[model samples]
Target: MLTDNQRGGIIAGYYLGHSCRAIAKVVGCHHSSVMSWPPAID
Candidate 1:
């Protein structure tokens, strides 16, 4: 599971037009991690 910071970073990255890999890099996680964000966010 992701920490609060990771979850928030992914959301911010998505809104900022960052790619999955880029979001992972910024959030200090793997690209697959972005795929697991809360379903409500999708």
Candidate 2:
């Protein structure tokens, strides 16, 4: 499971126009995990 900080970073990175793969790299997670983030975060 993702930590709250990881999840928040994913959400923030995505909304800041970062790609899922890029966010995943920064978050140290799989790209698919970033892609799987809920749209509600957008």
Candidate 3:
């Protein structure tokens, strides 16, 4: 599971127009995880 901070980072990164792959790299998760985040997050 992602930490609260990581979740926030993911959301922020997405909103900031960063690619899922790029966000995943910074968040230490797989790119697929980032691609799957939107439904789970917002």
TM-scores of the candidates are 0.40, 0.40, 0.40
Off by over 4 Å in 1: 18-42
What does candidate 2's lDDT look like per residue over 1-42, in tens digits? Answer: 999999888777666544675677778887665575555454
To one decimal, what is the Cα RMSD in angstroms of model 3 from the true structure? 8.7
* Superposed Cα deviation of residue 40, candidate 1 (Å): 19
| Each model's lDDT | 0.63, 0.67, 0.66
Candidates ranked by TM-score, best first? 2, 3, 1
What ranges in model 2 sit over 4 Å off? 18-42
1-42: candidate 1 lDDT, tens digit per residue: 999999898778666444555667778776564555433454
* Deviation from native of the Cα of residue 36 in model 3, angstroms: 18
Candidate 1 C-alpha RMSD relative to the actual structure: 9.0
Clashing residue pairs, candidate 1? none
lDDT tens digits, residue span 1-42, model 3: 999999898878666444665667778876664465555443
Q: After superposition, how far is residue 28 of candidate 2 from its true place, in Å?
A: 32
Candidate 3 clashes between residue pairs 3 or more apart in a chain or in different chains: none
Query: What C-alpha lDDT does candidate 1 achieve relative to the native structure?
Result: 0.63
